[model samples]
Target: MPGPAPRVVFLGLDGATEAVLRPAFERGWMPNLEALWDRSATGTLWSSEPMVTPVAWTSFLTGCNPPTHGIHEFHAIDPAARTIIPNHAGRIRVPTLWDAISESGREVVSLGLPMTYPPPDVRGIVVAGSDAPGLQWAFAQCPEFGEEIFRDLPGYSHKVLWKRRPRTLDELRSVSLRNREVFRAQAGAAERADARCDWSAMMVHFHNLDGIQHRLWPYLDLDETAAHQPEWTAEVVACLRELDEAVGRLLELASRRDAAVIALSDHGFGPCRALVDVNGLLCRAGLQRRLPYGTRLSYRLSRIRDRFDRWKRRRSPEGTSRRGPRSIEGEVGCDWSRTAAFAPFGQLCGSIFLNEDLVSGSSAAGRTIGEIIDALRAAEDPDTGLPLFADAFDVAERYNLDPAAEGLPDVLAPSTDGYQAMAKWAPFSRSLLRPDPNLPATHRYDGVIAIDAPGVSPDTRLDAELPDVAPTALALLGQAVPEFMEGRILDEAFDRDEASIGTAATGGPGIRPARRPIG
Candidate 1:
């Protein structure tokens, strides 16, 4: 007979990267993280192809690629309904880590995990993150837990207002501070829950780091000779220090429960130099249709009105407000009937959708796709003569996509730079590529991951990918790794016998006949 299984605690820091954390750790700004890295196996956790939050985290949870998990991007388009639905847990086709662990008779508590909105019916407690519109329906197993959180913590928010751009440094500081406070409260709540409940695994996610990087990347990445240095840099540093403290607290909690600790991020972060309007290019190629003359006139007038309104707001005593930028789709409506191919907005990639109605047959659609791909490949920056897109993928060939999947895009357009591909079909005064003043930071491919467990080798450097995390975690819990999962366990990070404990099982959720004993 084997002893009891070790509890596992996963701390997900959104957009955490070695580029930021390495410097902070070396400067002694993050002692807890430094200590964990010193004693644990640390490595770069590669993100998904487009490296968006939803897709990467989904890959982390499912041990499967985007195709198997069925989450290719943030927004899934419904062609028949002509609507875009936000990705959520309901969209996940495979069983997640939480489901497997809970089914093995271990209690799990997940707090503030993204893409978990409309929380699944697990054997344990789950509180959804950003996708939930309100705090009321954030929790699935425990409604009172959310109520207690709201009542206890003042200015408690499950998700920060990421879309809103700060007009002033003070406004940015205010938002960052509020989000930091919310993270602190959530971390404290997670610690308490772990202490009270009989949980085998507890996962907590923090989004403030990602928010701060997005809003203050200009200041954070500045040199001493920069033209203007905002006073809010100190606040950003303070928020990071607070995050470090939260890690320390969680580490202590994990220690008390005799749990192994794993700290990781879904994706990395970097400065976004410019935005590429892929839809505008499509319009130029005559692939995307233009609005009617009357509609175009109305749109021009609306833009004038909007500019006037913004000018008035800037001149007002209050100065500019923090309203988010309007969606390009809403601004320039797509004429689907005449359009052949159109790129839809995503975080760091634009998914090009072919209009099936416009292209009658499959052969014609293939020809249109080939033409669009050729055109995009031929496109070059007039100023630098550089390729606009880093890579373009045929969805069906690259991802082994299900041909029958609804709302699937035809092509994926990832920008050469880390900027988002904007879907703007209308012509504008600026060049095709221009600096996005509103959003200065975006995601990168190399995320951060650190694992510290008993019997695991110390000071080890492991090479890992996003999908590998789920199976490694399952192996830690002595659960069988599903054969359908595409990732392999990190044998280098653990002792020989421990690493070999996982058995590959086929079939679905009911395939696990019995839980393996903890080695």
Candidate 2:
């Protein structure tokens, strides 16, 4: 008989890539991950269409596409108010992996997973990641238990590691020190969770690596001067070494539970050479128009909720603001009647929202959308003669959605390699392209996923996307995959399956089985 069900441990390395990991492993900076890599089935985990953290990680949690889960980007647009708002834990339209596990008479200890602000009520421990306003609001259960960890863990935070970009070696050191502190805190929290509850499954996410790669890409890459700087190199190595130590501790815990360990990332990392001004291109192409009565009371009225939210966040116990994004669209008014389309917001990829009424009930299959796609595809940097968008495709078609579906963008434009979308729209904004003055790197779709467990083939290759992680984890844990999930179990990774894994689940709260005639 099967000895209960195999436990699972998920370790999320946010924005991790082979370019960095292979090198870090070769240097022996991350011995723990290297050891796991040696025995696991490794492959590229394709990210969401946008390849952004919020969208990709949300997909990982739900095992559903953006349309099914209802989160396409980090910030969602309140269609009624036409106001942009932060996408939070409450926005998920389906049951998450944690919920699925708890519903199956099991418990989960999910720590610091992205898009988990205002943590949901679950059977075991759950804490918010970068989305929470503060730790005060991050706990899902046992407030007293979580508060103890928060108080004891030093330099723990749910926001950016560095307040400013590290421009010098000294600044990099400061960022590294703070990052190591955060790593220790999260690792400590994982340790404490075991003493509190015997969880069936556990997931620990480390997000600082993404920020580090983004702000310190030059130093990580072979930039000659930046790579050769001993002080800066030392700081990077020290910071990642601390992260490796923390991950090693968790891997030890997995061994104690005899759990199958799965390591993954939301997306990979790469250097950013330029920023594509999304809105600037739209305005220049005569797709969007500005309001005649520019920035005034009307603009402030639309953003009053954001103001109130900020005020409320400030008054929270931690006093740290998890502020929603404030972009030029909120400050500058738009002439909706005359505008055919507008860019709400974006980072790695651009999102374009067409005027709903103008486009009628047809979603991505609209004449205006086609014209805009043509215009976007034709755009090129006059200075460098390089195309702005690497690919411009319909989100609905890409995600295989109903043409009449709502709450999704009409088109998505992804920048070419080494380019990121900057949806800047302001009265004074100029040019279709500009030098990115902030982070030097951005995300790619080549995130990683590796599973190390008994009976799994060594050195096996996995071909999967973000949503596949959750379903595969469920299958490994002896649970039926929710029927709504589009991903399937990676049967190739396991050699001892007797055809019971990857079965579809029946009706549940977040899922309603479709009607079918019995034979």
> What lDDT would each prediction earn against the true structure?
0.72, 0.75
Worst 10 residues of 1 by lDDT: 510-519
TM-score of each: 0.86, 0.87
Worst 10 residues of 2 by lDDT: 510-519
Task: Compose the digit string of candidate 2's lDDT tens values, residues 261-282.
Answer: 9999988878777788787777
Clashes of 1: 0
Return the lDDT, model 1, position 49: 67
Residue 349, model 1: Cα distance from true site in angstroms: 0.8
Candidate 2, lDDT over the whole model: 0.75
RMSD of 2: 4.9
Position 159, candidate 1: lDDT = 68
Off by over 4 Å in 1: 1-5, 162-165, 222-230, 296-332, 335-337, 382-386, 402-404, 424-430, 496-519
The candidate scoring highest on lDDT is: 2
Q: After superposition, how far is residue 86 of candidate 2 from its true place, in Å?
A: 1.7
Angstrom error of the Cα, residue 179, model 2: value is 0.6
